[model samples]
Target: MTLSSSDSASLPAERLGGLLQSASFHPQQTIALGISDLAEQAKEDRADKLGISCAEEVGSVYAAILGAIVHRDAGLAD
Candidate 1:
């Protein structure tokens, strides 16, 4: 789930912060998978609310963002 600079560029700081906060409520291993699932759900919710078809793309971006956050929190990132 490592993201290139470009891949991470479009992630909103506020959204990432919200995900981080949500992840904090779970254990480390669970947080990783949970964030991914949460991101997918968020993507679907946003797409439905906005009448957009970009859920897949949004989910991918959020997955990368959340993965980076989880890896860093687990002290697995350099």
Candidate 2:
């Protein structure tokens, strides 16, 4: 199951992290899909936390790692 963009953006870091971890433990395709969904959600709206900057930073790192993996598999990674 995938989360809606607004829903994802509003999710707490712990919740999002848990979902991401769950996706990572699944098949590679599932991980890619999860990251893709999160990326789009991030673009639309960032999570509103007490430490917004920290949340965004952590989210970006997750995106970067997942994106790198996807790009590498697609022969697009440098």
Candidate 3:
């Protein structure tokens, strides 16, 4: 799910999330320990990501995704 310089304004959040989910970054590892532990869904996946030490890349990846989502949702990317 790669995007070129153009046509990026139309990318959807859910679609992007699906792509990100397949990446090396993992949400559970980046999130705080207590919070990650409390999350019931994807707990095992999260733990696995943590075990693999993917936490460092998660925040930046999430922020970029959020920025894109916000831009599209607000019609500001145009």
Best by TM-score: 2
Greater lDDT among 1 and 2 belongs to 2
* Candidates' C-alpha lDDT: 0.69, 0.74, 0.58
Tell me how candidate 1 scores on lDDT.
0.69
Q: What TM-score, over all chains together, does every model reach?
A: 0.32, 0.33, 0.30
**Which model is ahead, 1 or 2, in terms of TM-score?**
2
Pairs of colliding residues, candidate 1? none
User: Per-residue lDDT of 1-78 in model 1, one digit per residue for the tens?
Assistant: 443567445556665555456655654654466467668988998879776557767988999999999999999999
Q: What is the TM-score (0 to 1) of candidate 1?
A: 0.32
lDDT (Cα, tens digit) per residue for candidate 3, span 1-78: 344546334445554445446444654443333234335536887788786676667777998999999999999987
Worst 10 residues of 3 by lDDT: 29-38
Clashing pairs in 2: none
Question: How well does candidate 1 match the true structure, expressed as C-alpha RMSD?
Answer: 24.5
What lDDT is reached at residue 1 by model 1?
43
Q: For candidate 3, report its TM-score.
A: 0.30
Worst 10 residues of 1 by lDDT: 1-10
Local error of candidate 1 at 48, Å?
10
Give lDDT tens digits, candidate 2, residues 6-58: 86787667757777677757746665665687688786675544368898899
